[model samples]
Target: MRSSVRERETVARWDVARPSWPSRTAGVSLAGFRDSSAGPVDVPLVPHPAVTLVVEFGDGLFVVGDATGRQQRGSLVAGLAPGAVRMRGENVTCVEVRLSPVVAYAVLGVCPAELDRTVVALDDLWGRDLSRIREQLADAASWEDRFALTDSLLARRRETGPLVDPEVARVWDRIVISRGRVRIEDLADEVGWSRRLLWSRFRSQIGLPPKRAATLVRFRHAAHRLAAGDNAVRVAADCGYVDQSHLHREVVAFTGMTPSTLAGDPGLAVDDIAWAEPVAHLGVMRKT
Candidate 1:
């Protein structure tokens, strides 16, 4: 079986490259999440074109699609643990479909015993070429055929829960509007709650604070500049840092690696997608 993506609008669509990964052919599959292209999302690494995916197996694998004329060239990678926070650089376009852990939990509904096992087994299949699936969708296939298939997979996994909570939605909205550069206090105020209340919501829902989110946003900006060969000073300034050292110091605090090290460290390059979570989403350029 294959996973399908349907783009009903001209604005944003999943631009998948031709089928690869011979291992992708059958099993469970789900659609990608829908996100806005109004601004940039802070992700790790400087991915050229990527297909960002968030599945259930060991924190879903990160993907990017840099198809010509189809998407932008930049970097953004995230894990599937809680919320996947990614940053796509300017001129980098891609459709990110990262399912929340809650979504997986909802899909599973706590029935399957080998939750991770089932997800891992079907992980590759989830991303298999969905051209067939897309075609059926384009032809206005039955909702049961599409949605029901997904439901069945979750049922098999015994994962079930609410798709997401209101607090999660609230924080995500803040991330988009602020470009990942807002404060926890501000978020607290916006939601008409106290700091402790906001923190509780964050830990339980988003799993991170407003400050961490802001940090990641800044870090993403700086990483993009470095990938594009931007001067550290300029990148720092552009990303809301006091100076180049500010960028480096904060990046170290959050990522334990320097921008210079990241740029030169070819080993860090892999399947060609940002995949790890930093200490928190501190500014790549202004964490400390």
Candidate 2:
């Protein structure tokens, strides 16, 4: 009976029928978006700690790197983007999965560090596996099926791929659960590792060192609050900034926009339609 109950729970957890493909799996969430615009729309992609996988089923989605000045069109893996980027495409339809850095190595077969502030074609990373998934996504009958296919593929890949160090995973989870409020020293102690060793391993596997990762996670929470119509001053105070000035600097650094401008950013506005609920479910978007 317990086994039967567990099976039922598992099915319920993987139910792809949810609004934005909230998964029962930790460290993974998926969202499907469809746009019919004839001309391209620019979306200011915010830098976050997650490694994102974008699979397009319709028109191409081009990732334009602000620094590299190169554009990658079609399915891709965006790794721990350090600064703002933009996505330009028209009549776009895609399924985007955000992977917590903790599990990205297992799913992508590459350390998040390799992708730091870079975008690579998905075919380059996953090879033929990505092409196969794209075909499956395009052929799938409905959004639910597409999500289910995506989830099953991720689950299979993660199960087969090598995992990050357990200690590193624990530290990442702690930072995320604390919404980036925890200290690196405390995390090292909790995970039974010296600070130096923890820093090295964490950066190698998770893309960013502990301190920077914490700040990125915190900033994402603050960005969401601003988008939700929270006052910039209150958001700064609530998200642990030293002052509104500090908050402004962090926001500008990550997004290249001031707090008020970020709040009004049409690009940042896509979170409402595409990822708002799944992000909250992932625990990245915290109540604080």
Candidate 3:
């Protein structure tokens, strides 16, 4: 997705690159983005089920905050936040990693729950190590080299960080496999826990409660389809929404946009460009 000037007079171009990651790096995928723009720009970002790590090496980027007027900096970790967000930046080059909530704790040494609906500086998680990584990334000769450095760092963290509860992991896997269509009660029963216990544990481990996570996952699928030119009505039906209206509400709730507006959103349309190649590569790695 070569970003071009939009109707709003902002000249923007984004190039995405994929790097080979280790097979042992399960539940994670990496993408590199190079953005060249005339000046500062605002891009809308909607909610997603997974956590994200953004490391920027060019002009600063920050998550635009509401009410409190607090902005999260580049080189940040963002949890499964709700509503809409606008990323403000100019001439940014960065590497982004998408981490499944199941592996977030292991990779970051922080429970997903503590990060619920929030973004924080990566240094807050990895301390001085983040500065060192940023310096190395800035000096790296190629995107592949930067990716390798990041993979090594995350691998070490995952190896040493606390493991998630087995039952919690199982519940998460089921939700993904079902594409968020699975019932909460069914998940609770499958995990051998009462509904109350399952709810508490799942939220603690995965950030969002089971039901909310499922909704996000389902909405993510629908959003991608819409971005791919699928009809909203068909997407709603295929994604298990009651109807187009139901899908509309979900889209509005997560993105603060109507279905048509979200379909035209460049930030989301670029996700395919950013993730498709790396995700496909990761799948092949898993099979081997």
Candidate 4:
């Protein structure tokens, strides 16, 4: 499952790999990346609709920083829709896991509400267990082995961790299935919960209120479409935006970049290879 990505007109290349099969746990996906460039790499981190765990194992420095200038070194966890972040490193190698907010609570041993829009050291949450997992991944012989180790770790954590309310999970699935176009009121009706109850439960369990979650999902879809070279005007309409300006605003809010700049972002360019399965799970595809 190894693929090579070389940006046009540049010497940057990435060795990206994915698991041979899906994770045993649902709502989890993994990808591995090893930088092949001659020097340090810095890429803007685009906001997405899932919690992210980066397990760094290479003999290099890995740093994540937010717009506020806070930085965390080594492996880290980013909450859903962490705004205006960046990743920088030299000779980076890591297995990146994207966990749907629906299951992130169980797998991460913390309420999503607690992680909302923040980046934290994985060691702060997982403590010594994070160290053991990093060692296991570094000792693994191949990317497939690393993926297996990660999946096993997540499955074990999920078994012992608390679960989100079923109603909340249902609403999340609906939001994703509609590509964030579903109304919160409609979701409340479908789940037989009052608007107030739905908002509270969804916010605590999903790390974001229903409307904000919907906006994040919608923005994720539009961002990927823009990254695929779609015109902002057409993408806005297709992704439920009022107009191109609406899409531009959301893009700026989420990534601190205009739609055109995001289209050429190096971080997103590798998504087609690194996140193919997860992107497909979201019912979107990168343009070939």
Off by over 4 Å in 3: 1-12, 59-63, 66-69, 277-288
Q: For model 3, where is the 10-residue window of minimal lDDT?
A: 279-288
| CA shift of 160, model 1, Å | 4.4
lDDT of each: 0.40, 0.76, 0.77, 0.85
Give the top-scoring candidate (lDDT).
Answer: 4
Which ten residues in a row are the worst by lDDT in model 2? 279-288
Query: Which portions of model 1 show Cα errors greater than 4 Å?
Result: 1-97, 100-160, 264-288
lDDT of 3 by residue, 89-164 (tens): 7667788888889889999889989988777788789887788888888999887788888888888888988777
lDDT of 4 by residue, 180-246 (tens): 9998999999989999999999998999999999999999898889876788899999999999999
RMSD (Å) of each candidate, 1 decimal: 14.8, 8.5, 5.1, 4.0
TM-score of each: 0.45, 0.85, 0.88, 0.93
Cα error, residue 145 of model 4, in Å, equals: 0.9
The positional error of residue 12 in candidate 3, measured at the CA in angstroms, is 7.2
Give the 10-residue window scoring lowest on summed lDDT in candidate 1. 1-10
Model 4 lDDT vs. the true structure? 0.85
lDDT of 2: 0.76
TM-score of 4: 0.93
Higher-ranked by TM-score: 1 or 3: 3
Between prediction 3 and prediction 4, the one with superior lDDT is 4
